[model samples]
Target: MPASDDVVSHRAGLLRAPDGEALPQRVVASWQRSADYGVDLETVEPVFSGTPVTDSLFAECGQEVLSGLHRTLENEPISLMLTDADGLVLGRLSGDTSLLRALDAVHLAPGFAFSEREAGTNGLGLALADRVPSVVRAEEHYSLSLCTYTCAAVPVLDPVSGRLEGAVNITTWSRSNSDLLLALAQSAASNTSALMLARSQGRRPRPAPRGEVVRVESARLEPGSGTAHELGEAWSDAVGRAAHALAAGRVVAAVGEAGSGRATLLAQALRRARPHDRILSAAAPPPADVETWLALWAPEVGKPHTGVIVRDVDVLPAWSAPALRSLLVGRPSGAGPVGGAVVGLGGGRPGGTTAGDHPASGAGWAVTAESANALPAELAPLVDVVVEVAPLRDRVEDVMRLAEHVAHRARGRAIEFTPTARRALESCPWPGNVEQLVRAVRHAVSRTNVVDVAHLPAEVLSGSSRALTRIEAFERDEIVRCLTRPGATMKDAAAELGMSRATVYRKLGYYDLQVLRD
Candidate 1:
């Protein structure tokens, strides 16, 4: 289908679309955003940004995935593309000379940025923008020049961390059959992400410490709204488990997503049982300084009133594992001085004594990581119990309570969220978990007396839910867009959604979209 008069008029800054002829809500939203960005409707001149990412892990893995896909579509006039998180085109592969030339004309070749901010609303841009798989068909593109092509793209995320790495885009002529384009793009993107994860797991990234020892502040321990009783059973249960394990002189590892309160859970547990214990925290240092970093802290770990929490033990070098093992498990008799001049953490004198010289049980030990499986092999055996901190999304009921708690802490009083803001918070996937919620609430409270939808971060408003599949996200967005439109009624929304009024009403409640109206 060619560009409709409605689309042409909408592109010219007229938001009106014929009631029955309205475009997909995602496309309409993108068009509005493009206008807001000052994108030219007549052309799409994507900015030439960074140099091509030819040597990086993402590019290497992406190239391999695209290469295999290219062979499958050998004679097809389609192009496969890879872009960085910023939507800078890193690589492109295609056998169709005509399509290649046309792509180059629109600055779709390597080293140009096709992000919505740079190029306008297109497949790769929308995927990167929303961090979801996207399909932009003819006339759906914000830029008129891009309307000649149909594009399917899927954002690639770090398999372990869930960070957006980039996107895989497949493009063909506007009239080409695109029934399988999105699935193909999704598969290639998933494979590229898997390969990246596999390569990274083979060799752990270098550990970079955030600095030195930090005394877990007593201020954080003071009663707040995010107290044990209020944070839900899941949270309280994890803290209880850690406290029990630590009180029994057992090494505990708090495992979960990076910011899901792994350290907070362990620290809260300690404050409850041993408030007088000096809880010191430090992150794993660089590979070269591992020995020195360990040596500096080894002396404190042997004391009766001291407790230690090492962050990101997953990144510790393989060679330094045994030294860390010695710290937690104690040094064997006749073994060389651990870390060379470091006193034995297993409760021994500086001169070098057996594991029995001093009971290593006096001080508490714990570490935090993404999971128990991520811990170093040498140190894994030393962890007596693993306390799993559930990600924020798992406990949606806790979001508002935690938000209230975080806001009070930020403002030194109280701040509240509007119904719309609360729904946005509750429905979000919260990839950064509790830590992110705290930061967002703090940020919002600092700017406003009452947190509203406008005060929240952009990611929170537009974030894709991890629990929702790509198709579900598309449907959810459609329902939300239709229901939330000004002057839209149930009959109109149901008609727009192609569902019965009853079905639309049921789905509206199911998606927690009532807040969209408030």
Candidate 2:
């Protein structure tokens, strides 16, 4: 159900994030995600900044673009930023010195990670996360600090890989006409992607020179899974297999513990397989129209380049399994499933032993597919290939790179991780995988500027005596343990803590411990 028009208008006038009932489901979902990331709606802190990148693959890809755009603006009060796929600032240009100072205060510089999780619902982050060009008007942003400005951003995709390589964002005071700004931002991003694709293909003719544009295309999607291995090996052999599966036009299943960055890898594959095609996304539990959505699958019947990517198919409902199978089953190559084009199944526990069975080589292969592993039995046979992503604990050396990645994302700027701090980070156990690491790093960045070992969360560095986190951890633990006791209640716990019930619940919500209570 939708909100009343009067209620919607009131919220819109106040520049508040509309209640879930008032906004589109996707928009509400994004807002919920923002809150979960701990973004403060009232006080927008510049704790999250972007990180700097060396002269590398993307460093030169979109060079001089900002300067040229600035020239065209001719001293207009605007700022332009080019960021890598992670929202890490790569290049930035500003026309007005005053506006420049204001943006700098918010860490909107080259090399900061402006990802949605870090910066709340802003242009660059939303564009990258949703993979669509967008405009964020004043107060539309989750953070109050960004309310005075309007921004438009578009994701820049790798021509060959179809991966989200970066994004281009144009920012101005909220009073400006954003419709024009959005078009300009999209044009800028398109031009940048074209430049990158030209280099990758070596055709160099410009003007969509390859005659095809690509995005989210990668078998080697993302920066492999970590940086501690060879090439600081970000990708494990499983990723290579996943890539192979996509290229082979096989039904690819990427299984791993949650937060292993499987989506990042598969999204790249989707791009490579489709190149010129648009992908319609459906989740497990199969949306009501999923069959209908999948039925119109033909790239030759005026739909020459569209595909279906049903996520988390491992848990695909039993009833819908046959429907999906019948829709895909086996339709010969180039019919609908080409370049691993038909569908991509993401997430589900791997089969067999807990990756303990396969024994990871330095490249970090998590598992080998067998007859009875973690994947659902019915869906397994339908899947043509499988790639496993190992947990962060298995790839211990990669923690620092992962931390830096998160820090750049949360802080929206660069913060060096000292060798000593790196060792401290690597020593901890990451039980929640990437999600745990991201939360810990975001907490640390919010608390300190340097990101030293001392800056990390107390939970991350267990058995270490840090007066503040130690006390907080001890108190929270005691509270949780007591609350979980048989017949325990919030009233009893609040009395024991010598605080009001409201304060107790506030702290519970703050620490995400509300679930511990009845």
Across 1-518, the per-residue lDDT of candidate 1 in tens digits comes to 23343554556454333344566555665665566567887798777776775787778899999999999897889999999987899999999999999999999999999988677789998887655678888777888899899999998866646545789999999987666889899899989987876665232222224536665446454322145346788898778877876776666788888778887787777766677677777776644476688888777666667777887787554446656766754765223332212111232322222334332535577888877777765556556677788899999988998899778766778787888888889988877788678877888888789777667664465543334434555676677667655578879988988999889767655554545433
Q: Which residue pairs clash within candidate 1?
A: none
Model 2, C-alpha of 454: deviation from truth (Å): 62
- TM-score of predicted model 1? 0.50
Query: Which window of 10 residues has the lowest lDDT sum in candidate 1?
Result: 338-347
In order, how many clashes per candidate? Answer: 0, 40
TM-score of each: 0.50, 0.43
Error of 1 at 196 (Å): 10
Q: Please report, in order, the local distance difference test score of every candidate based on alpha carbons.
A: 0.72, 0.56
Clashes of 2: 40
| Count of backbone collisions in candidate 1 | 0
Q: Which digits, one per residue and each the tens of the lDDT, describe model 2 over residues 1-518?
A: 22333433455455433343344333443454466566666544534443566465455656556567778895888888887777777777776888989888887776566776677778787776666677787767767788789989887766643434777888999989888999888778777766665544231121221211122133233223222233135454555656555555455666666556565456545454445444433433223343454444322122334334444544332224444443443332212212211133353432322211211111111112211253433345445556666777777766777787778767788877766567657766565567678777887789778766556554554422222233466666656555544576789888887888898877666544423422
